[model samples]
Target: MTTALLPWSKFLICALLIGLAGPVLTRSGDAIARLTGLSRSWIGLVLLATATSLPELFTGISAVAAAGAPNIAVGDALGSCVFNLLLLVLLDALSRDEPVYRRVDQGHILTAAFGIILIGFVGAFLLIGRGALDIRLGHVSIYTPFLILLYFVAMRAAFFYERRAGTIAFTGEKGTETGLAGAVGRYLAAASIVVGAGVWLPFAGLEIAEVMGWRASFVGTLFIAAATSLPELVVIVAALRLGAVDMAVANLLGSNLFDVLVIAIDDIAYTDGSLLASASPAHAGSAFAAVIMSGIVIVALLYRPGARFLGIIGWISLSLLVVYLLSSYAIYLLGH
Candidate 1:
């Protein structure tokens, strides 16, 4: 195969591997969840969420350091939020019981709300970076340090709330208890598989964008973003099937929140001017879409919409899916 075909081929293989790894991740998460006193949301949001976000983390680092394409790094991080929110539709539809919104905890509204703020920070910086607004200490955006601080604070807030909420929101049964060593081993093994596929995704993304002469922003936003997020898709389906509904939803929100942090790392790796400033203005669209979609989720969690339409999912799911499709299309046009 020509070099052009190489990346597409590798992308498919890695995608398949990510799918196969999902169930193992879900099962291992259950063991770990039971071992810890934290509820399902806590486990999924903190541990599983961070684990699955490894793709964006590694992809961002590689895009800047190795690929030397900060735009890809920017698109992947911002676009992943849109992709992650869109997965709510899949999670809701796959739910054989009540709508997923009804199943997960109301506490997730805090997560969704926090996500909106983080994405908004990104959007603000992207637009500001376009002009002479250089709120920077050095090569980095000043917002980078502030965002890092906010992320930890948000995490602490979420942790306290979930811990106090008890199991009222958790739908899944705790897994059978295992020795701590066994749980640790299983968690590490499953995480390793996910990390392996995640690490290779950026290479395929850069090559395909170059061969097709497609903008890195477009390729990263849609193709690379969706591809790297395959783990979230798999884990959501697996966790829901295993009766861990909160884990499924919490994982998405946590990952989206974490996705923004990748930008800070990208800023450091780029070695150029501000990474956000280096990105096309089109990325603001993705960041804005994240805010809007996260609003939809917060509404669903607060309202707990009982009404289902357009098939298996609820109205929130449909609305979110539409917004994402429109946003992706908008990104495409902007790229052209």
Candidate 2:
């Protein structure tokens, strides 16, 4: 009972804090976007997305450094991707005025496609492990450097693509304009709250995993990931409600892309071997799941189907839900 209370209480508090942080972050970020003369999509992709993704960053590093559970970190990264994709299920449903995809700019396809590429890279690296030759400089994969490099490349590429895409509509936050410095200050404060909660999340998750006798990957993928990803759900809902379509979509894709980068950070933190080598192959299931859902998202962007299946959401949302469930089950089975 005592052990349960710790994670549960922390989880409840952190989850609520992240939920509160979401709208504040998004609003401040939107004002920052306007002030900086950048598009809301870009702000959502970089600033807001990074702020929300802090949990994964903190949780992954904490899991490796403090908890010695690199697999949990790995699971959180992959599982967070799965969970972020699942958020679109709600995004689509709440966006009942129009199908979600039709409202966003086509530039998002670049973000989604690049997300797939990065995730595929990590998945393939883990799956091939020792079967392929390792160019390791002690503990870290040579690819770790490449992963970091590729992430920046992906960011720059998406940044330029969106720049060229031109004129993304940012539904401004009326009555919330506090000027540039004030917005920056507010964004940072809320971000700190989010990050603080994020730092505590993995510890609780690790304890709960131990108490429950669940595998690190399973616990990380489902529990820790779900907790860390609360900000994404909050921002997505808020963005959708605000009618910032691309902002909502870009946040999820960008967060997933950054989440994969956490693997590189984890690789550095572990000091034992490539973090990939240390984690269960069950994680590749998440990478593959991320790829599959990303593909469907890209398809949704390009296809933009008119019909809402079963009078609710689109085919892609349903497909994403199905894929996530099946992949999660497979990972759990493999983990046990």
Candidate 3:
């Protein structure tokens, strides 16, 4: 009995540690952004997003390098993309006064669009870049460099767009008085905790897969993906409570972008072969699911629906939930 519960216990512990450290990361990130005079949207997309995604980044490396589970690596990254979009449903539900899509800046559509592009790129690589069609540049996919380049381009684009749009607002009772050096220090400390926990996460996931007789793709996508994403959930809620809606929205969409970039990093870490090529094709389903969900977000941002369907969430949130459930079911069927 004790042996049976060991994997889950370890997984939960890592999740708890990440959850506790996550808010600290966000606060420190916010401070750094404030001190540096960067826009809130930019901060959320770059600083907050990267801090929250530390677990995914570390987990991917461990999954590919130590656990030798390429499926887990790929599934976790792509699955987190879908799961983050699912968080939009939660975000929409929490905003009781108005629809979340209508409340926030439309500039987020840019982030979501970039997310779709990156995720679609990954899904395309997984589907077509297999066997003879696969392209490699010395143990890594050629897509690796493109992913990295695209990420930088996306960041630059978002920075200038947010600046031009003049959407730089920091809401809170008090300003961030912490010195820049102090904020950086706190960020690093919180990040180290997340990194350590993230390193152990893949091992726990591997054990859970073995003990439950489940596919690594399923375990990684559904279970491990949610676990690593706990930090984002925590940060998003904290940001919303502080009235930083753009930060919350940017964090979720930005995390998706970074999650795809993690795949490129995973490919480099995975010395065996191309990480995407080695992963199960079922993961492509999650990738495309994310792409569809991102498209829904773009529509929601443009349409800006005011009325809620059942007085709980808007039509956009409902669509997101439906797609998320169907995609999970499909992945379960394929993994099993």
**RMSD (Cα, Å) of model 2:** 2.5
TM accuracy, model 3: 0.95
Best by TM-score: 3
Clashing pairs in 2: none
If scored against the real structure, what TM-score would every candidate get? 0.93, 0.94, 0.95
Residue ranges of candidate 2 with Cα displaced over 4 Å:
168-178
Question: lDDT (CA) for every model shown?
Answer: 0.84, 0.85, 0.89
Which model is ahead, 2 or 3, in terms of lDDT? 3
lDDT (Cα, tens digit) per residue for candidate 2, span 1-336? 886787778778878887789889888887787776778789889998899899899888888888888888899999999999999988998888878888887788888998999999889887776545556878788889888999999998987776566643344333344588899999999899988988888877777777878877888899889888998898988887777777888899899989988889888987777788778877898999999999999999999876888879988889999999998898888873
Query: By descending lDDT, how would the candidates be arranged?
Result: 3, 2, 1
Q: Assess candidate 3 and give its lDDT.
A: 0.89
RMSD of each: 2.6, 2.5, 2.3
lDDT of 1 by residue, 1-336 (tens): 487788899888877776676677777777776765557788788878887877888888888888877878889888989999999998888886788888887888999999999989999888886567866777778778988888888899997786577653444544444565677787778778777887788888878887888887899899989887888898998888788888999999999989988888788777777888888888999999999999999989889988789657788999999999998899888963
The local distance difference test score of model 2 is 0.85
Error of 1 at 303 (Å): 1.3
